[model samples]
Each structure stands twice: as structure tokens, then as C-alpha cells.
Target: MSWMEDLLLLGIGGIAVSVYGVVAGLLLLGIDRKLVARMQARIGPPIRQPFVDVQKLFTKQNIVPEHAVAWLFNGAPVVALVSSLVILLYLPIGSIPPVLSGYGDLILIMYLLTIPALALVAGGFSSGSPYATVGAQREMVTMISYELPLAIVFIAIAWRMSADGIGDPFSLVTIMQYPLWGLVGPLGLIGGLILLFILLLVTPAELSRIPFDTPEAETELAGGLLVEYSGKNLAMFYTAQGVKTLVMASILIALFLPWNPSGLLGLGGILAAGIDIAFFLLKLVVVVFASVTLVRAMVARFRITQVVGMYWLFLGLMGIIALILLGIDAIGGA
Candidate 1:
């Protein structure tokens, strides 16, 4: 195919991935709510609750606060949702390659991950609400806090791959091809597990979910960063939240659990792809449950100070130790 034809095909693939991301993200959110409720012994909304909420939200009128910077306030949610969708296009489904493979890598995705959060901060500050302003500040701080350990997790894995002579160590496709577990020996395996745990801890913060959800502490900030958003604008942010959750889980799968049962069972063709995709979704569910739902259910919101310490101090130290172990493992192997 010519370049124009290839571009058109990619556009079609991008659309398909966007739709899948939104639907799957919302579904995962609904499941999370239901699971959390069950843990608390209370009945929860159905698995379609997020979908219903989005539908209702779009029908309601969008109210831009009179004092708000109308353009920035109105634009933030669109940016957030669109950026979240773009991140999904670069992440592969089970047996499928990413829609825009070779054009992007994990580092680009890491940077892309921040755009939605920055958009939220911009939206909140533009709203001109004290609560939102505070929320935006907290969101900015949270992003800063998580960066060290998050980068450590990425660099450790990619470096290990590089030591193993894996080409394109920064590529998600390469990570999937030689999962860290298979490449690592005993100490590296422990280090890899530690990195996975650290990433799981970061997932909640990345999505602004509980414990780390200081930015949207509804109790204290009265919806916090989103205090002034309503109707369609709110819906887009809500959907973006779900998509970000899905994106985080998908990244975790690519890193830690990229195995396919089909290959082990000698399956082929459509059957292999079907089974692999099914297995991948199952991993997403597990990752989401462990990282987001379970953690949120078990913990109260952390103070902003505590949030910083947890990520930068505690997780950061752990991440450093993990990197050291991986280094030792590399030397020992050599």
C-alpha cells in the first residue's frame, strides 16, 4: 500500500482502538465500583453504571461558571479525553500490535500520560474556584511525587533488557516479546516483581484514584478539581478517568504479564488470537482489582504530605533497591 493508503488504514485503526478504550475503560470502572461495594457488604450499581452515567451526563446542560476562563475550562476535558484515547492507540491488545507501532515507544507513552493530568490542572485553575485551585495544586504535587519511582520502574526494566542484549529495550513490543520475568534470573526476578508492585502502587495515583485522590477529595474539596465542571464537560472528564484506568492496566499487562495461554497450549491462528486477547483482558481485570479497587477499598485518603512521602521517599527507596538488585543480577549473570 502507498503511504496515503497506509495513513487511512491507521486512521481507521485509531478509531477502532478509541472506541474499544472508552467502552472497556468504563466497563472496568463499573466492575471496580461493584467489587468495592461487595467488599464493604453493600449492594452496588450494575456493571453498566458508568455507561448509564455518561449517557445521562451528555443530555444535561454544560454550565460554565461565570468567572471561569470559558475557553480553557471548556477545553480541558476534551483534551483530557482525547489524550487518554491517543495513549490507548499506542498500547497493543493481546496478540495485536499497537495501532501506531514504530512511531512511538514506552517513553513517549510515559510523557503522553502526563498531558491529561496537566489538562486537569489547567481546567481546575481556570475554573477560578478556590477549591479547584487547591485541587489543581495538589494534582501537580501528586504528579511530581510519583515521577521518581515511576521513572525508576521504567528504567530498571528497560536497562535489564538492554543488559540482556534485547534490541529496542524502550519499546513496548520488545518488552512484550521478552517479558522481564523470562529474561531475569533469581535476583532479577525479585527485582522485576518489586518493580511490578511499585507500578501497581503508582496506578492509583496515575488515575487520581483513592489514597492519592487528594486532587478530587470530594469530602474536603467538594469535588476538588472538578468542582466547577458540570454536564457534558463533567462527562468527558469522567470518561477520561475510565480510559486512563484502562490504559494503566494495559501498561501493567504489557510489562509483567504478557504471556499467552494459547502459545503454551499449541493454539494457532484465530483461536490463538482469541484466547490471547481473552487472557489479556483477564490480566487487566486482575491488575485493576489489585492496584485500583483493592487498594482504594483498603485505605483512606492520604494527606498530601503523606502522598509525597509514600511515592518519593518510600517507593523511591524501594525502587532504588530493586534497580540495585537487577544490576547485581546482571553482573552475576555476566
Candidate 2:
């Protein structure tokens, strides 16, 4: 494709992914409300409730704290939105992400994922609100806890792919074509399953959902890091949140559902793409439902220390074992 063609596709694909994020995130929130209602045996708001909430937030007046840094306080939400959107641009949504895949190393995606969290921390610190400051601290702590296991999980996958003798292409596009899961060798499958569980655990925390929502613990911090935001500023944060939710889910899919959409494996293009997209979204929803909704219901919020301990002790150990297993399997194959 020509440079202009690539640029156009990138713009269109990026916008499509952003729109999907908005729609899917809102739907997931509504689904959570309904699911919770079902679990609690109570009525729930309409599926449109999240949309209504965002609209109301937008209509609210913007509030700036006298003690807040005016520039950063105003710029925070934009930073979040841009960071999250840039991540979406790097990811493969319904089909693929353009303009980023040539250099779309998994490590690059990892760095992009950190951007929103860093932006949130900066925004919170600049707000000069006690709640915001506390939230920022919690966010940093949570990032420290989860990042190790998440990195291990990605590295394990890449390591496994290299062991398969695919010549070390760590881009999602390359890994997507390999049938690592199809190996299903006892140790490899076991390790992959363990890593998948760890990834699922990290997903909600990364997205700041229920149990790991310490950064925005509303009951305790009165909206936590966002306590001081209002109007358009709040709207940007809200939208970035929606985008981030989709980004996390998409990453899960890309890592786990690496099936081909172009039907290279004896399947026709249209049929293969349909199967790929369907299974991809289905896997994503299942992951979201389990991690964000079911886990939230099953577990109570942990103390900060307990949260950190859980990630480092349980999830971290799991990742380490997973990598070891993959290494052993790779050696055996070699």
C-alpha cells in the first residue's frame, strides 16, 4: 500500500477502534449492572444508563480547584484520552490496526499501555486534592504490583513463539499466525492456562475495575482520583476509561485468540474472518465477565498491602512458573 493509503487506513481503523471501544465499554458496564442485579436479585438500570451518566457529566459545570495547577489540571483528561487512543491505534480491534504494525513490537504495546496510568497519576498529583493524591499513590503501587506478572506473561508467549522456530517475530501480527495453543502439549498447555489466568487477574486491575479499583474507590475517596474533576474534563477521563477497558480486553484477545482472520489454514477468507471475529469477541467478553464482574462479586476489596501481596506472591509466582515451563518445553523442542 502507498503511504497515503496506509495513512488513510490508519485513520479509519483508529477511528473505528475508538468507536468500538466507546460502544463496547458502555455495553460491558450495562451488562455488569444487569449481571449484578441478577446476582443480587434486584432491578437494574436500563442498558443505556452509562450513556446517560456520561451525558449528565458533560452537562455539569467544570470545576477547578484554587489549589490545583491550572495547566495540568486542565490538560490531564486530554492526556488520558490521547494515550488511550494511541494504544487503540497500536492494537488490532475488529480486524487490524494500521500505521503501527510495522514497528508494533509487543514491548511498544506494553509502553503504550503504561501511558494512561502515568497520565492518571500525573493528573491526580496536580489536582492538589487529598483524595487525588491518595489515589495517585494507590495507582502507582498497583502498577508496581501487576506489571511484573503482566510482563512475564507476554515474555512467556514470545519465548514460546520463538521456540516454535518462527524466527523471533514478536509483533502481534506474527504471533497471531502461529498456533501455539494448538501445541496443547501437557506442560505447555498447563503453563499457558496459568499465564492466561494471571493475565485475566491483571486485566481488571489494569483497567481499574472492581476489586482493584483502589485508585477510584468511591465509597472511601468520594470518587477517589477524580473527585475534583467536572464537566468536559470529567468527560475526557470517562471516555479515556471506556477506551482503556476495550484496550485491555483487546490485548487479552490478541494474546490468547491468535487465530487467523484471513483463512490461511484451509478456511475461506470471509468465513475465517467471521469465525475469528466472533470467537475473538466471545473470548474477550468471557474474560471481561469473569475478571471484571464475577471476580468482583466473589472477592471483597483488599487492603493496599494485601493487594500488593496478592499480585507479587500469587500472580508473580504463577508467571515465574509459567516462564520456566515454557523454557523447559522450548529446550525439549530444540
Candidate 3:
């Protein structure tokens, strides 16, 4: 394909993935509503309720706090939503590669992942509400706690990629396409699985889902970090959240499920794409259901202190073990 053709394909793919993100996000939320209701043995709203909720939020009146920094408060959701959209542009969807692969790297993508949280911090602090202030503190603590394990997890993956003879482990596409299972030893696989488990735990927290949702727990903090947002601003934040969840799932899929959608462009390619998408959605739903909703329903919310301890001690240990295993593998290969 010509450069122009590549750009067109890239644009089309990005748009399609964004649409998929919207659809998947809405679908997951609806499923969560129904599932939560069923888990509680209560009747839930209709499946279409998420769309209705977003519509209502958008049409609602804008409510800015008197003491708030107006510009920063207003800009928060825009930054969040735009960062999520940028992530989508960097992801490969099905048979399509990223629009700007030249600008993409796993490390870069990981850093970009922090933008939404930073946006939340700005929005929360600017609100000047007591609830928002408290939520902001919790958000910061959570970020600090989980980030260490997350960084170790990525480093372990990159190390495994290097061991595989994939030329620069930092290259997103290069590491992504390298067959992890083939390269890593048994111990490394075990460690990688543990690392993957930690990431799975962190994913919902990163996306502000339940259990790890102390920052926005409705019952505890009265909508918590988002108490001050309203109207289009709130809608923008909500949409950004939906996009973030999709982007997280896509990253997981890319890193772990890259083998599917085999590169042969024909019926085989179509079959590969279909199967890959099905498995991708299946895995995503399973993660959402098990880690997010199920855990939320089963366990009471953790106090901020407990959450901090949980990530730093338990998850951090797991990540270190994974890194050690990766290092051992590299030594053994050498």
C-alpha cells in the first residue's frame, strides 16, 4: 500500500476501534448492571440504561464550584478523553496496525496510560470539595502503590523479549510480535503468569472500576472524586473512562494474544481475525466479570491504608519474583 493508502487504512481502523470501544464499554456496563442485580437477586434497569445515563449526564446542567480553578476544572475531562483517543490510535485492531506506529513504543504507551489518572488528580484538586480532596489523596496513594508492580511487570516482559532475540525489547511492535511462550523457560512462564495476575488486578483500579474504586465510591464519598463534575464535562469524563477500559483491554490483548489473526491475507486471515476477536472479547469479559464485578460483590471496600499495603506488599512481591525469573532465564540462555 502507498503511504496515502496506509493513512486511509489507519484512519479507518482507528475509527472502527473507537466505535468498538464505545460499543464494548457500553456493553460491559450494561452487563455489569444486569450481573450486579442478579448477584443481589434484585431486578435491574433495562440493558440500555448506560446509554440513557450518558445522555442524561450530557444534558444536565454544568455545576462548577465557586472556589474551583475554572479552566483546569473544565479542561480535565477533555484531557482524559483525548488521551484515551490517542491510545486507541496507537493500538492495532484485528488485521490493522496502528495509525502512527512510528511514534509507538511499549514504554511510551505505558507512560501515556498515566495521563487519565493525572487528569483526575487535576480535576479532583480543582474541585475544592472536601470529598474531592480526600478522593484525590486516595487516588494518588493507589497510583503510587500499584505503579511499582506495573513497572516491574513491563520490565519483565521487555526482558523476556530481549531473551527471545527480538531486537530492542523497548519497541512495542517488536516485543508484541515476539512469541513469549516460546522464548521464556518454565520458571519464567510461571513468573510471567504471576506478573500477568498482578496486572489483571491493577487493570480495573487503573480504570477506576469497583473494589478498587475508593476514589469514586458512591456510598462512601458521595460520588467521591467526581462529586463536582456535571453536564458536558461529566459526560466527557465518562466517555474517557469507557475509552480507557477498552484501551486497557486492547493492551492486554496485544501483549498476550498477538499470535492470532495470522498475517496471511485471505480467508485464513479472516478466520484468524474472527477467532482472535472472539477470544479477545471472551478474555476481556472474563477479566471484567471475575476481577472487577465479582470481587466488588464478594468483598467489602478496602480502607485506603489496606489498599496501599496490599499493592505494595503483596503485588510488589509478585512482580519482583517475576523479574527474578526473567533474569534467571536470561542467564540460563546466555
Candidate 4:
């Protein structure tokens, strides 16, 4: 294609993915709230409540603290939202290849995943409130804690693929094409299941949901990292949270459940694409429920120390065991 055509395609694809990310992310948040309410035997907000909240927030005043770094405080939300959207461009949605698949891979996606949280940390510290500073520190601790198991999950799968002589094992497309499950033996299957469980647990921490939301403990820190944020700035953070949820679930789906309904049904063309997209959305809901809704409903928030210990000590050990099991399976198969 010509340079002009390439630019046009990039623009079009970027817009499409952005729209899908925002809409679907908010929808998932709404669904999650409704499900949690139902589980607790309480009436829930409408599925469109999140949209209403965002709209209301946009109309409110945006206040910058006199002591805060105004530029960083205001710019953080945009950075967070934009970085989250960028992940979708590298991720395969349904049966569609990523818009920029040739340009990046899973490792790049992993790095992009940290950008939003880092932005949040920057925003928190910039707020200049003691509470916000503490929250920022906690957020950094959470990020560092969960990263080990997350990295292990990626390495374990990629190692198994490379062991089987697959090139580009770290590529999202390659992993989706040859799912980790199909490459493993019975032992490795069990190991993969363990890793999958760890990844699901990581999802809540990545999104700062309940049980892992120490950085945003409303009761203690009075909104914590976002204590000084209001109006449009707060709304941006809210939308970014929703988008991050979608990004995490999408990555989980791509890594573990990359199957499409169209392929199973032996269909093709636009009809297949439609069915596959619907199926993909369904998978996203399942992931959100299993990883976020259900887990949050069952547990109370953990202390920051507890969060660090849980991720680095407990979950980290489990991930190592899973990797070892996969390694043994690889050797046995060879």
C-alpha cells in the first residue's frame, strides 16, 4: 500500500479501536457492578449507569490544588487513557489481527500495561497531599509486587512454545495461533491451569479492584490517590480505569482463550467476523466476572503489606512451581 493509504488505515483503525475500547469497557464495568449487587442481594444500578456517571462528571468543576503540580495532575489522565487505548492496537480482538500486529508483540503489550499505572502514580504524587503521596507509594509497591508472577506467566508460556520449536513465541499472534494448552502434556496442562489462576488473581490488582485496592482505600485515605481529583479530571481517571479493565481482560483472553466461534462453526466472511466478535465479548464478560466481580465480592481489602506478601511470596512461589512443571513436561516430551 502507498504511504497515504497506510496513514489513512492507521487513522481509521485507531479510531475504531478507541471507540470499541471506551464503549465496551464501560459496558463491562456496568455489568460487573450489577452482578456484584445481585450477588449481595441488593438492587443494582442500570447497565448504562457508568455512562451517566461519566457524563455527570464531565459537567462538574475541575479543581487544581494550589500546592499540586498542575500540569502533571491534569495530563496524567490523558496519558493513562491514551496508553490503555494503545494496548488494544497491539492486541488481537476476536478473530481480527491487531491493528499494529506487525509493529509490536506481547512483550510490548506487557510494557504498555505499566504505563497507565505509572501515570496514575505520577498524578498521585503530583497532587501534593500526604494521602495522595502515600497512595502513590502503595500503588508503586503493588505494581512491583504483581509484576513477578505476571512476568513468569509470560515466560512460562513463551518458553513452552520455543521449546516446541515455534519461532516468534513471544508474539501475540503466534501464541494465539498455537495456544499454550495445545503444546503442553498432562503435567503441563495442570501447570498451565495454575498459571491461569494466578493471572486471574493478578487482574484485580492490575485494575485496583477490591481486596487489592490499598492505594485507593476510600475509607482510610478518603479516595487516596485521587483525593484531590474532581470533575473532568476524575472522569478521565474513571474512564481510564474502565479501559484498563478491558485491556487486562483482553490480554487474558488472548493468552488463554484465543478460540473463536467462527472457526468452530466453519464459517467465513463478515458473518463469521460478527459471530466471532460477539463470542469475544462474551469471553470478556466471563473473564471480568471470574477475575474481578467474583473475587472482589468474596474478599475484603488487604493491607499494603499483605498485598506485597501475597503477590511476591505466595503467588510468586506458585508461578515458579508452574513454570517448573512446564519445564519438566517439555523435557519429557522431548
Give the poorly placed runs of model 2, Cα more than 4 Å off. Answer: 94-99, 260-279
lDDT accuracy of residue 317 in candidate 4: 97
Estimate the TM-score of every prediction.
Answer: 0.99, 0.92, 0.90, 0.99
lDDT of 2 by residue, 261-295 (tens): 45555666567667766666776677677778788
Cα lDDT tens digits for candidate 3, 1-334? 5989977977887777677777777777777778888898989978788778888988899999999999999999999888888887777765456667867777888889889898998999999999998998889888888888778877888877876667877765775667566677888788778877887788878877777888988898888789999998988888788778778777776766565545543346567778666766776676667656676778777788888898999999888888888789778866
Residues 242-321, candidate 1: write the lDDT tens digits.
99999999999998888889879999999999998888888889999999999999989999999999998899999999
Ranking by lDDT: 4, 1, 2, 3
Q: lDDT at 149 for candidate 1?
A: 91
Q: How many backbone clashes does candidate 3 have?
A: 0
lDDT preference between candidates 3 and 4, better one: 4
List candidate 1 segments past 4 Å from native.
Answer: none
RMSD of each predicted structure: 0.8, 2.3, 2.6, 0.8
Q: What are the Cα lDDT values of the candidates?
A: 0.94, 0.80, 0.79, 0.95
Question: What is the RMSD, in Å, between candidate 3 and the native fold over all Cα?
Answer: 2.6
**What is the alpha-carbon lDDT of model 2 when measured against the actual structure?**
0.80
TM-score head-to-head 2 vs 3, winner: 2
